[model samples]
Target: MSAALPALTAPTGRRVRVLPGVYAPQHDTHLLLRALAREAIRPGADVIDLGTGSGLLAVAAARRGANVTAVDVARRAVLTARLNALIARRRVAVHRGDLAAPVPGRTYDLVISNPPYVPSPHGPPPRRGSARAWDAGPDGRAVVDRICEAAPSLLRAGGVLLMVHSGLCGTEKTLRRLAEHGLSATVSDVAHVPFGPVVLSRMSWLHGRDLLDRRADREELVVVRAEQR
Candidate 1:
């Protein structure tokens, strides 16, 4: 069974952005942040926040005395996150690139992510716009799969990866993928959140694809924590 975490006080809104395309914090964001809170981060630990939308995770890590590097694929997200870090007075190194590609040859003690996992009937992620923040390709594992594939390389010998995604995208698949990549993984946190506008709009398609049940109006999100030993 997945564990539970306390809710946090920070803000959340996937498409609610200060910049045109930068995704604001959302429920999943808060979920991951709460999971990060439960971790006993060592002082000066190396930390990387993948898809650091508003630099919330990075700033939080920095506040905890961890050296933080935030990465995002969207330029606007990078700018907004940097602005957030600046305004918050937290020193965070922000980068722009797809998933984990930006930080090569560097390993982190803790890698955190709240990635795009909404299952889209459409082909691929959008070329632009706020939709880029939530639209994952069919089955919603596009970015999550990339993160799993990158975890073994990005994590130190005993480093940890904390990632959150919707239940519509197979939580078991995530756990198994991480294990296949040699990380001891488990569901560390879980919460049931109502379907957002995007998911609700795609309800018929979701049901047709068997990704969601007809009567289910809510989706369960799981936070998978994987540790390389």
Candidate 2:
């Protein structure tokens, strides 16, 4: 087990700028970073950041001497991540595509993601809006489930995946899915955080779905670590 790392206030300091409609670094981002910090990333290790919004995690991995590639579905997010990587003077390959589609037939030593997991009553996530960062399908597994299925192919033997998502999306389900895919997985870290604006907006819907209690003021965020053996 890895010791807990201190919370980071901002990823890549204050240099990274988030454009409109791009997801900014928040508690979930920081939590994932903390998990990443515990890993031993050798120099020149291949790392990929899925859903790299502002490119914070990609930049951080580059700073650690890893060859980083970042992917995002939104054009603005792709641009934002590229700009942030440039500003950080880090060599990050930023691509605009869905999940790992931009890098086919490629595997990484480390894969990281803080994908959309908020259960939204709004059907699927918006194609062109800020809500794409958090508004997953009604069960909040739209992207999470995809990641679980893609993770096995994304990782090389001995490669590790560090993913963070809201407990609302089903932590055990993530672990089970990863295991079903032949990876040894566990919840590496967890944090209790107050509902963000997106979740707060759908509090009533969440309660109706029994995903949350009426008195619940916070949600559990979990970092799942899975390794391809």
What TM value does model 1 have?
A: 0.92
lDDT of 2 by residue, 46-72 (tens): 999999998899988999999999999
Worst 10 residues of 2 by lDDT: 1-10
Q: How many backbone clashes does candidate 2 have?
A: 0
Residues 1-229, candidate 1: write the lDDT tens digits. 1123122245532222246566666778788988998998988999999988878888889889899999988888898778777767879999998776777899999999988899998889887778878999999998899999999999999999999999999999999999999999999999998878999899999999999989886889899999998
Candidate 1, run of 10 with poorest lDDT: 1-10
lDDT of 2: 0.90
Write out the backbone clash pairs for model 1: 12-25, 13-25, 13-26
Q: Would you list the C-alpha lDDT of every candidate in the order shown?
A: 0.85, 0.90
Q: What's model 2's TM-score?
A: 0.94
The per-prediction tally of clashing pairs is 3, 0
Q: RMSD in angstroms, all models? A: 6.6, 6.0
